[model samples]
Target: MSVDPKTRPPRASAVRKAVQVAPTAVGAFYATSMETFRCMFKRPFHAREFVQQAWFIAGVSIMPALLMAIPFCMMFVYQINILLAEIGAVDLSGAGAGVAIIREIGPVVTVLVVAGAGSTAICADLGSRTIREEIDAMKVLGIDPIQRLVVPRVLASTLIGMFLNGLVSAVGLVGGYIATVYMQGASPGQYVTAISILTKLPDFLVSEVKAAVFGLLAGLVACHLGLNAKGGPKGVGDAVNQTVVFSFLLLFLANSVITTLALH
Candidate 1:
């Protein structure tokens, strides 16, 4: 028997609602993101505050992540060296691995760390203030919450990400080199030669640019979610979790697109 149109599911209704809500959510998110970006540049650049935030994000928060990543990098290099040696591709080891790590993994991993540590902290702080009406209180006092709160955090994240990318790249290279050359018994000169041949100035530029973009995205996502957070403590926690998850996903997607385009 043919199905009657009257008894059919309201697929059109669900589609229409989704289409309607999509634009509204997109508009709201974009508006908030742009406002935060503008707020980041409006105030006087506070060197001391920037430095403090940088120290926390780039130094303190980076430590645990680096500690975990270094050993993993070392292990990866050792395994690669063994495999390459078996396949007579040992000459491809040095700069090839280094360049790959810097141009791709470095920024990606740095952003992941930032999302987990820095983004979570930012979201929680802002969300708490929002929930407690401190953000509203600022408006009542003629202080722009975006300018005072969002700006500093955004600036801090961007600067910190740039710095952390450099730090992680160097540490990863060193760890990989030591592991491959000494631990894995790959000749030191071979490793150095490989690195020297593989790495280029263009790779460094691309990596730095990726780091900057990742930093901006992470900060924007965290601040946007936090500022828009409603409800109470549960909302704050949800915002923090969402910020990290979204940032991580975006960072990986960006890395893939950038890498594909850059290499192509």
Candidate 2:
């Protein structure tokens, strides 16, 4: 016998509601992102909050960045050196390392760390605030939560993104150098000198730009999901997970688009 509609489990209804709300959620997120960007230039910048958030994000991210960069860059250089040695182009190993690390690996790795650590932290903080009704209370007090909370966090993420990009690039280059010189038996001087040969000013700029954009998007995703979170603590956890998923999705898409445009 079929169950009565009223007696049926609520799970199906909840699933349907989620499915129906997905598009609306996307639109709401986009609107919130635009508002956050617009508020960035508003008066009374939250310098203290920005600094705190930046320090927090950096603290969570730096060690992971180092651990990831060293092995990744070393492996990259090792593989490239092996191929180069086979073709007698071992002197160009630095060029290969420089191009890959600066243009792609640095920004990508930074994105992963920021999304995993920084964005999730932001989401958890705001999600907690949301579940505590703090955000609603702020609105009741006539405060724009986007201006007060989001702009600073987004800016901090962007700043940290650029900084992390530079840090990762440096560390990766050092790792690449070690791999090339010690492991692959290439000349250290050649590795250092040839690094700038294939990689140029534009590449550096694009990589930094990519990092900034990725950070900004990650912050936006986290904030949007956090602010919209409901159903209490479980909802907050879901929002944090969504923050990581959506941030990575947006970041990789933006990377592809920006890289393509820059290439042209």
Candidate 3:
């Protein structure tokens, strides 16, 4: 049976809503981003707030970063070692794992943890403040909420992202070393030497850049959604969810683009 025409959405109305949503979302993102940039460069900076938020983001992300770093590094190293052995390149295990981890896995895993943990925390805190009209109160008192809140959160997230990248890289290298030396029976000296020979300092720098970018974008998305959240508690929850999902999407795309440009 066909549905009643009257009960169906009008094409015009649906199109109108769709048209309105894209511009609204884009405008909101643009406004929040510009505000964040402005807040970042202005004087009378929120150093205390930045340090607190950075510490909080880093603290919350540690466990997840470790948990993510170890398993994936081990599994990748184990598999690559087997393949390399078939070609008589087993000694290259550390080089392969080290290069791969720093070039890609390090930043990706660290930012994944940061997005999952830190961004959610920022979103929730801001959402609660928004719902309670604390943000509005700040405005009424002549305090700029964006400067007081979003700027610090974004900086904190970026700094924490960079920190976590280092942590993940260290953990992944350690895990890969164990897997290569013991599980794969590779020579420890050869493994270390290969990594030293193959991976350069620039790889680490690029990875750090990716992590910082991911963190900054995640913070922007979270703060934007949280600041605009409506419908009370439910809206805040939705905004938090959106922050995680959108942050991940933006991050992976950014990773691909950054990797391509950096490598080529």
Per-model C-alpha RMSD: 3.5, 2.9, 2.4
Q: Which residue runs of candidate 3 sit more than 4 Å off their true CA positions?
A: 1-6, 9-20
Q: Who is ahead in lDDT, 2 or 3? A: 2
- Residue ranges of candidate 2 with Cα displaced over 4 Å: 1-19
Candidates' C-alpha lDDT: 0.81, 0.94, 0.91
Clashing pairs in 2: none
Instruction: Report the lDDT tens digits of candidate 3 across residue range 1-264.
Output: 987868877996788887989788979899999988987888779899999999899889999899989999999889889899899988788889989888889999976898899999999999999999999999999999999999999999998999899989999999999999888778999888889767899889999999999989999998999999999999999999999888999999999999999988
Compute each candidate's TM-score over C-alphas. Answer: 0.87, 0.93, 0.94
lDDT of 1 by residue, 1-264 (tens): 987868867997788787998788668778988887676667565567666766767755678568856886787777777788898898778866787678876887788788889888889888999999999999999988777777777778888888778877888888888888778777788887788687898898889888888888888888888998898999998899889888998888988888888998
Which residue pairs clash within candidate 3?
none
Greater TM-score among 1 and 2 belongs to: 2
lDDT order of candidates, top first = 2, 3, 1
- Reference-based lDDT, residue 195, model 2: 93
Point out the higher-scoring one by TM-score: 1 or 3. 3
Q: Stretches of candidate 1 above 4 Å error?
A: 1-22, 45-48
